[model samples]
Target: MALKGSFERYGAVAVASHWLSAALILALIPLGFLMQDATGETRLIFYRIHVLVGVVAGMLTLFRLLWWAAFDHRPAPLAASRAQHMIARITHVGLYAVLIALVVSGVAMTAKSNLGAGLVSGDVALISPSPIRVPPRLAHGVAARLLLALLVLHLAGALYHHWMKRDETLSRMLPRTR
Candidate 1:
């Protein structure tokens, strides 16, 4: 069955980017939180991995956003009422916002926070291969918090759609496409 509104199966590029991003975020979030609780070498190791993934995610976000604008390729809207449509659109956009926010926040936190000293790669020079002495204001007090809040909202919306609404909010992203 087809989705509602103009929502259609994402194109090849969109689908590929979507899945790659999903896998990365899914892996990164827990790893990041876990690293926060670690220290010394282990913390350093996770920090490096986190930065490595963040840089890649940042690149992917740019490409995906560009693809969305240039290719005009996106998923079809869900087959729901106007209210549902609005909620779906808001949620989807929020997802993008959160992902970008998280990526940018982490990058800023490292660069401006100068926390990069902790993110060593044994000798890898992915991004200057050094620690940031002071992460920016945007990355610290406000932006990072905003990212975390948006992430919670995004997850809540997903849960709402999945359990409360019993819709295909998450499922549609699957390859099967209903």
Candidate 2:
């Protein structure tokens, strides 16, 4: 497999970043729900894990953007019209925008709540089931829901291309031997 993308396939880096980000997002969603509902040390532990994973995922996102800016050379839309191509591009941009918003809001919420420093220094116990609602925290929740919707749309589009349109659109992103 090539480390750089070609007209027919994604690079190894792109494929790895895509899968890792997806996995992290999938894990983080459940963790977010659990942490929000939890209390005491349980919530604290979950929050720490969530924040750490989110940071890692955010770093991966940064690298993915850099990869696109510096090295991306993937194939064009195989048989799609100009309108379809535009829509695809919009969706991709929206996904990245939503992801960045989610991470930023989450980090801001953590800082505003003092969860990170408190967790480290034992300054305050993260035991509040009904924690204070700040703007960033609220935005984080909203972004989570929006991200879910975007992910569903992305999956639907890929499935449509693979099952109905009989295209390699999905396979091109899939991590498989060529």
Candidate 3:
């Protein structure tokens, strides 16, 4: 496992970042929903956990984007029709954009609503209700939905490449085995 990507496949760092981000985001989607219906001490606990995990995921995602830009290059696109290639590119860009949007909106909502302070003081009253329709909260919700849709498109593309095209597109991101 090289640190940087090769022409054929992603490097170890990229693979690790991809899987870790995927796991975190998957956890977050469910956690976010659960946090909505929670109350009392359970709500506070969920809020605390959600903030902690969300911060980690946001930072990791930011680092991954920086790494891709500054330190790495992805493998060349596997042979495909122009439309397929275009769709893949769009999906990739959308994924990155939506991830960034989610992070930004989450942070903004936290700061604007004093969520961190509320969580720290164990004052659930300080936390804004999810139904308030604030800009950042609204943006966060929209971004989450967009991320889900983009992920579905991404998985569809990967599965198409792996099963239909019988190509290395999916394998390129897979962990290398001995």
Instruction: Report the number of the highest-lDDT candidate.
Output: 3
Instruction: Please list all clashing residue pairs in model 2, or write none if there are none.
Output: none
Clashes of each: 17, 0, 0
lDDT of 3 at 63: 92
Residue-level lDDT for 80 in candidate 2: 84
1-178 in candidate 2: lDDT tens per residue? 7788888988888999999999999999999888877877777788778888989988888899999998887776689878778878878888899889988997887677767675676543543654446779878888899888888888888998899999999999888764
Per-residue lDDT of candidate 3, residues 35-76 (tens digit): 888876777888788878888988898899899889999898
Q: Is candidate 2 or candidate 3 better by TM-score?
A: 3
Q: Which ranking of candidates, highest lDDT first?
A: 3, 2, 1
Q: Write down the RMSD of all candidates, one decimal each.
A: 5.2, 1.6, 1.6
Q: Mind giving the per-residue lDDT tens digits that candidate 1 earns over 1-178?
A: 3222135554556657778987887777778667757656666677778878877987898888887787655555555689867765776677677667767667666666436644443432333333443544344335445555666766787688789889777675555633
Tell me each candidate's TM-score. Answer: 0.68, 0.92, 0.93
| C-alpha lDDT of candidate 1 relative to the true structure | 0.64
Two-way lDDT contest, 1 vs 3, winner: 3
Model 3 root-mean-square deviation? 1.6
